[model samples]
Target: MFRHVKSNLLLFLLFFSGRIVHAQSRAVSLAEALQFAQQNQLTVHNKQYNVQVNEARLRQEKAARYPEISGAFDMRYNQQLPTVILPGEFRNLPAQNIPVVFGTKYAATAALEGNYAVFDPERKYNTGKAKLQENISRNELLVAQTDLALEVRKAYYACLLNHKKIKLTLGNLGRSETFLRNTQTLFQNGQVQPVDVDRAQFDVQSQQAELQKATLNLNQNLLSLKYQMGFPLDSAIVLTDTLLLSGERQAVFLPDELKVEARPEYRNLQLQQEQENLLLTRNRHNALPTLRLYGYYGSQAFREKFNFTNTTEKWYPVSYFGAELNWLLFQGFLRRAQVQESKIALKIRHNELLIFERDYVFQTYSKLLAMQTEQQNVHVREANVQLAEKILNVTRIRFENSLVQSQEVTDAANDLLEAQTSYLNALYDFILARLEYERIQGK
Candidate 1:
């Protein structure tokens, strides 16, 4: 009953799990898939935009350090108010002989202003912070690139494995059907029991069920790869690198220092910690006064010629050069509180940096162990598959000569199926292990 239910479930999955269209397909390469995923992934696209934004911001920050020049022209007209005499005993309106005059007044001014900060403790530190921020964004982009490549490789491998599984399942189904036909023929001749024919029929149905499941799984994996590559859902593609199961992507053992240096995520964290330290220093240095040397050279002009400077030049001259020092004497206690906050933040970042380094070390070691184990399994599983194939060949001859029972031949076939499946699984695991290890190593 359990077997029958399982078989029904597989049939349902085959009918509904994925869409099917029997059509010729084109092949996709690993490199092409990875490139397409990087270009099409929404997250990667966003990160690329963020890098541009950060670059613009850094340029603005750097520009702020240079001198700025601006010009302003102003004109104002005002009306004067008239003075009135008070009506008092000492100064009566009849005795008063005073004049009240109301007139308009105008003032026009034009000047160019320029300023440069010769020395500012904060600006100097802020420049470095902007650079570090740029580095952070760049590292974030690299991290996105690495993650997308890893995902593409995994998905590509999945589709390839699923295709193999479908083929394997279909082959098993054909063999089972053939076996059922042979058993029926033997039963008619009274050479085998009817029970053997029934069992052969059951095996054929079971293999057919598994084949359906394999077909469903293969199509689903293909769809997933298409989604990753930003291809149309109805589009058909065949993987070209089926025979290229695994390739060497790493050295036997890279130097620990090299991994630490090349890992983008690690460098990003290190930059963050440095930024935190710089911020803390800025907070502590808040007590230091900022000094600036500013100078401006401008010309003034009036609607009518003015005698302020009778120079032959058509414009009036107004130039000034000065130095100013500013110290934050008091803010309603804002500076002190900021310094305390920054110190606390720096402490938190320090702890986080420690944790990151520890985890990175652990991850590197774990990957190394996994890669070694997978390499060993590849060799062992390959040998097991060869032995199973040889055994199946010998059993087939014995069964044809009437020296072995049909059940014995069926058992050998089942063993061969298991061995082949086990070898394929081992190969797949080896690939997965290598990918995982590389991912951790940030290769």
Candidate 2:
């Protein structure tokens, strides 16, 4: 009896654990979807790394302005002492040629060195250029983030639209089945012809086919949404948000003025211009001379038998400080060509900025017009759907009262479905246009 109880307990625990795992895949709202994509998208990660790389480069350039300090230890063993010819008077010998060896078999030296730039125009310009490049990288990261958010929102809305389509199709299929059943009952009572029954059957089959197609399309859109959100494709996800036409219609409006400078692309272009100016400055400064200050302090030891470690052995101290001036008298006009190139680049960027500003204004105006048109379309489609629904209801009543044929009722049902589909499509377009307009405004 104890073994039987243990087995049941184990089975219960296994079932409970599976439920917990399944529960982890909960429904996601639009806000949660956007947040998840921001955290998980690979493109955002790569852009973030690019910003870090630029920061590191800026630090490297700044370090060059400060004094550089280094230390070293070097040792040498003389296999053969250097030989030198000695004068006869110095050696107290005859004037005949004589060669003698110099002193130590082992030598060692330790030194500390330091260098500081006193004046360098090119280095100063390069530091400024590095700072501008870092700003450019930051703006590029912002661009990537904005683009990803827009893509996620678009995909999310598409999924919502497809979900709505499937619901409408399923509802129509249910109504079609009811109509077929009513037609069959009338035919059995000898009130309707056999062809009428066949027509109702055909209507039901068409609706069923449409429902199947809609279901397939919905699944495809859900997969696309998952891909945009960086969610695992095999995982189950339920979208908790509903697309309402009323909320979107309230957001349509035209701004009095567009802030072109607020966009990251515009800022990036401005940064490029600044960088080119700095480059031009650096090239012109390259012609000027550079001045640097350097100093070193060290101790040298020499021993005949590696006895420098002995207390009695003496060491020599060497110290010096000096300044250097390096002037490039000529370099085959390379500096001149570089300066010209930078000048041309700066001019090109200036023109690009103007072109972009003008184009941005035009696009904003065009999108505003499109939003107005879509807003009108939504109203028209909404009224048409209501009208179609009323017509379908009247046709059903007439069929029951023997005032119309079953084919007329089927035609009315198809018209209602068409109207609803058109309405959903209009809503989809309006929502996307609003999203794009908001993005352009940098909201």
Candidate 3:
């Protein structure tokens, strides 16, 4: 008995602490949560990083157009002097062979060399491709943001709907408890059978069970909302938004005004198509001849015994500038294969763009229809809830006047709860559908 009492006390303390935490929860609106998610969500941050990386790549490509200058130095010693054979007739010694080295035993040289592309057909296209890639990355970041906003909306709506359900459940629970007390009073006055009192008690227990279930569901939905918002789940939060529809009807867009091109995803695909076309052009231009201007200014020293510091030693300076042209007449058909591959890829991307446009048109129309249907369902459910309330009030009055059975009263209460739950579900669906429609419109 003592152990049971101690466990009950512990449960009471936990329940009381939970209630206090709930009371102190910070209130947040849907817009505030979405803004917070945009600032702190890991996915959005990663997408932003990708955009930065592509921007840097664009700078690198542009910088490549400048001339390149480099300095080089080298020192070398000949282990065995290089020898060249000369005819013996030069020395007037017939039938004799003599070997002579043409270069110094030790040598050192330093030079600064510069190169500039005089004519490069592919460079212009490469810069263009880099700029296009940066634009694509920016659009991709926008796409990620849109996706994250949709996820936040879904989770937020679910949490708000769960909160509304909990409120309605609590109201029903209160009414059930009151009904149970009235039934017990009638039994004490010998006005109703013991079975009727037992039935009333069971109805109250059922309502308690429902309240417990709704509370658990609400807690889980809150955790989901927190995860979507990138917020800490251990912290307490209260949603300030209510699950209800505004009296005004939402504006619906016609098919012609859908403007699929406004969507980031579609724009990204178009950019990709441009990239593929650019690749094909670049590959085709690869066969063109490239001309480059190169120049070097330097000095060299040649010593018989590595005596470069000797006053007698001298340094020879050299300078020259020249233009070189290189034409890759053939690369074993490698360029041919690249050109063919690029053509195929460009075609593939074009096909994807067409398919995407068609699918987006269908999807947007479908969502619009769903939003309209759900809006009508919300109105219908709202009316049913009102009717259920009236029916419940009448049933209770009938029970008090001894004109109806206890089971009828319980059934009426159940009907009202179901009607209220259905209404909340309808409202949630309508809101989600509307959000999706807006998303498809690129809002």
Candidate 4:
């Protein structure tokens, strides 16, 4: 019995301490979380591999401009058969050696060789191709970064919006409880009708249901934010941002001239154009011949004894140095076809790029208009929330002074709660719309 009692006490103490710890825990801000993800997220790992892959490709391309060196050694054994025609002057090849190498023979040689390209137009364009490939890889990584940031921002704002909903729901529930108490007091004094008390009780119950739903929504969005930020399991935090739609706020819009020149999409297209030009140059260069210098030094030795007269004791040193031009006289018109194919692809990409620019401008223009409209909505909702608050306060005072019906107080409370929620939603929508605008513009 004592042991069980002690365990119960220990459990209570632990639960109480956990509550204290939770109360003291600080919330991680958005910027700090973003920085952590940059260093720790799985997407960063993928981007790192992408950079490494392009780096390897660049190295391979640059290596094409250098000389290649290689060496090899070979050893083999063989057997030979011979024929005899005359008795004394037999047509047998070296009768003594024929018997010596009758079953198996051994020969070995080792050599080192090298080749350096003296002239190639393709190599010149290859250098440029490698650099442009690096640029494309960098842009791709940036796109990933921007995408991840956008996801984080959306999740963060969602959590903020849900948190505001929870607060509004709780406030409504409290108001219901207070109004129910006032209605009961009035009934005890015989000032209000019994239906008034019933309606007030109904309001309290409805607000309780809404409060529960709002809490669930808040928890779900918290889970989403945790997933987006890649936080560890069991992390608990409360949002610290204020939930209010600003009444008067404005953004400085960029001019059309500056917007087109500074956008990432435009720069990406420009990079692609340069890369295609380099490829065309390479295809054109392929029509020319190539020149290279090849050299090798080798020696073959088979000297059982250092006797110069013996056939088995032969050793010689050999060296070679030469330059060669390799020209494909014809490939059955394949080269011409390839060049024409490349030219057509280049033109296609150019046309696609033109279409893309037009679409980008249209999209930017549309997003700007959407953001402006959302801003106006935010202002209207903010004003409504403020006015609703005043009405709820005045109605509550009048009910307390026996100057209003319980239904009037209930209506005012509901209106206030709805107004608060609408304003919060508008606040979230405006922020998200602006973020989308900025993201698409590559700000």
Candidate 5:
């Protein structure tokens, strides 16, 4: 009996542990969602890596200005040593010439060498260009993050809107069910015809279908929101935010002078233009002379046998230091072509920057106007929903008293649903427009 109890206890513990392994539903606010997206989004990570790459490039460019040093070791074995012809007078044999070997059969050399650019016009410009490229990459990352924040806000609002819609549809369904129940009671009392009962039942079924659709839409929106937040798709999530219709209204004032510099794209383009200018300078300087300081120290040994361990064996040392000046007199017109290309690129970027500035101002103005219009529409739709709700209640009461037809009650219900839907749409649109306006203004 003890053994049986032990087995049962083990089974119970396993079952409990399995349940504990399942993750609980997470409740997230809009701010928390945006934070998660910023930290985990793939695009943000990619942009961050791009910034890192440019940083590394900048470091490389800076390092290039420093001296370089290297070491080398070499060994050679000659089966047949090289020989040179010697005149006979050297050997006291007049009018005669003989060939004699001069070098040992084995030779080895060790060397330490270094080179430094003492004067290079292009290095300075190139380093500056690398720094500008790094800045451009950083700005691009900022642009990505800003765009993601706006997307998260929009998706969060969409989910809220859909959730409210589901609630509205469920309320409508409840009302239809109640109306159906009341109509059946009236028919039983001989106060209403069977056709009235049938109509009420039809309304209930239609409302049920509508509720189902609304629920599906809410779920879809929730999934999309999770995707944007980089949250687990299979995990349950509870949005801890409530839609406050009255609190959504805020005063917005457009700036008299738009600051294009506040926008990352504008800064990125500006940096790109600067980079192009530096490239042009570098290309123009490429035709100039380059001066470098170089030196090497080496030791060589030659032996007829493998006797490197012999302390008495002498190794010859050679060293030299000198400055070299290199002037690229010609390169098939490559430097000139590069300079012209860079000049053209700079001109193109300058024009593009101008166009972007104008377009940014225009777009900001347009978004502000649209946001105001949507805000106004939200108010109008709110009023319409209130009126529709009142009409629905009146119609339902009149139908109960046999003063209105079943069709009239159905029409009122439909109008109320439509009004609610319109209000939700207007609210979402206003939120979207406001978010866009803030983004455009670089707020």
Candidate 6:
């Protein structure tokens, strides 16, 4: 009995868990989709990592301004001692040359060295450029995030449009099936011919085929949306947001003038220009000398035997501190070449910034115009859909009263489907254009 109860409890838990999973698969809104994509998209995450890496580089550059300390422990054994010549005048052996082997057979050195740049133009420029580069990386991340959001939004809109098309197709399918039934009933009453029933049946089959196509298209679009959001393709998602074809656009919410500098691309270009300028300055200053301070404090031990543990052995202390000034008088014109290259690159970036501004303006205005046209088109298409729906309804009633033929009802259903599809397309176009405009504006 205990075993049976345990088995039943396991099955109950499994069923309850399945229900929880199903319930968790609720609808997602546009805002939620965009937020989720920004958080999870691989492209955005990679860009974020780039920002972090640059931040670390910035820290490294900043730390370069401080003193560098290092240590080394070296041991050497002399298999054959080196010989050196010495003057014997100090020993009252005038004009005599003496050869002597010096020092112990085994020697070891342990030292700590310190170096600080008193004034290095390269280091100074490096820190500045690193700061600028870090900012540029952050801006790049922003650009990635913006691009991801745009893609996710477009996918979401496509899914919504597809869903609407499927709904319309289903409705038309139902109508066609109903018409077929009515025609068959009329045939039974001897009011319609067999040809009318066959035609109605054909219309129903056509609608079913269309519904199948629409359903497949919807599935394809949903997969694209999931890919954009970095969501699992095997998971199901239902959009909670609906498109309103006749709704007003939010263009008035935007500023009249586009802020070109507000764009991440433009900001990156500006930073590049600044970094290049710093490079040029550094190259020019390369002609000047570099100043540094260096110090070494260490002790060296020497013994006849290899044993370092001998307490009787003496370790000599060595210490030195000095400032150095190194002047590279010339570099075979490499410095000049670098300066010239920097100038050319800076000029190129300047031109690029200008070109970007011009192009951005052009794109923004073009999208604005397209958005306006699509907005107008949406209203027109919406009106057509409503008219088509009315015509379908009227045709159905007339057919039931034996006033219209089966072909007329089929044509009405086709008309309604076409109008709805066109309406959805217009809405999709308008929303996309509006989104593009916002993106170009760097909003």
What tens-digit string does per-residue lDDT give for candidate 5 at 1-443? 34335434643563475355334678789989999999989999999999999999999999999999999999999899888999999989989989998898889899999999998997898789789888888998999999999988888888888778867776776677777878888999999888898887777767666766776787788788888888889986778888654556655545546888888888888888888888888898898899999999999999999887687999999899999999989999999899899999999999989999999999998988898899889889989998998898889889989998988987888899889989998998888888888887776
Q: What tens-digit string does per-residue lDDT give for candidate 1 at 1-443?
A: 35445555765665454334324555578888887788888888899898888888888888988987788876655455456554444555575555555432544567778788876778868788888888888889899899878877877888877777776676666666666666677778888787777777777786776676777777788888888777677978767777343444223544244365577877887897898788878877888887777777766544333343545636557889888888988778887888788888878877877787788788877777877777677668778867876776677567656688767767877887787688778767877887877777778
Of the candidates shown, which would achieve the greatest lDDT relative to the real structure? 5
Stronger candidate by TM-score (2 vs 3): 2
Superposed by TM-score, candidate 3 places the C-alpha of residue 361 at a distance from the truth, in angstroms, of 2.9
- Candidate 6: deviation at residue 254, Å? 6.7
> Please, what are the lDDT tens digits per residue for candidate 3 over residues 84-173?
998898899888888887888899888999999978978879799889988988898999889989998888888877767767776776
RMSD of each: 6.7, 7.4, 3.9, 6.9, 8.0, 7.6
Tens-digit lDDT track of model 2 for 1-443: 34335434543564475477458766899999999988988888888998899899899999999999999888889999899998777767777667889968899888999999999997798789888878988998899888988988888888888877867766676676677777778888998999988887777677766766776787788788889888888987878888865656765476647899878889988998888888888999899999999999999999878776787888889889999999999999999999999999999999999998998898788878878888889899989988997898789779977999877887898899889989998988888887877777776
Clash count, one per candidate = 1, 0, 0, 0, 0, 0
Pairs that collide in candidate 3 are none
Give candidate 6 regions above 4 Å deviation: 1-26, 73-81, 87-96, 105-110, 245-257, 300-315
Quote the positional error of residue 203 for candidate 5 in Å. Answer: 2.0
lDDT of each: 0.73, 0.83, 0.83, 0.73, 0.84, 0.84
> Which residue pairs collide, candidate 5?
none
Weakest lDDT window of 10 consecutive positions for candidate 5: 1-10
Residue 345 alpha-carbon offset, candidate 3, angstroms: 3.7
Deviation of model 6 at 226, angstroms:
1.3
lDDT of 2 at 260: 90
TM-score-based ranking, best first?
2, 5, 3, 6, 4, 1
* Estimated TM-score for each candidate: 0.77, 0.90, 0.88, 0.81, 0.88, 0.86
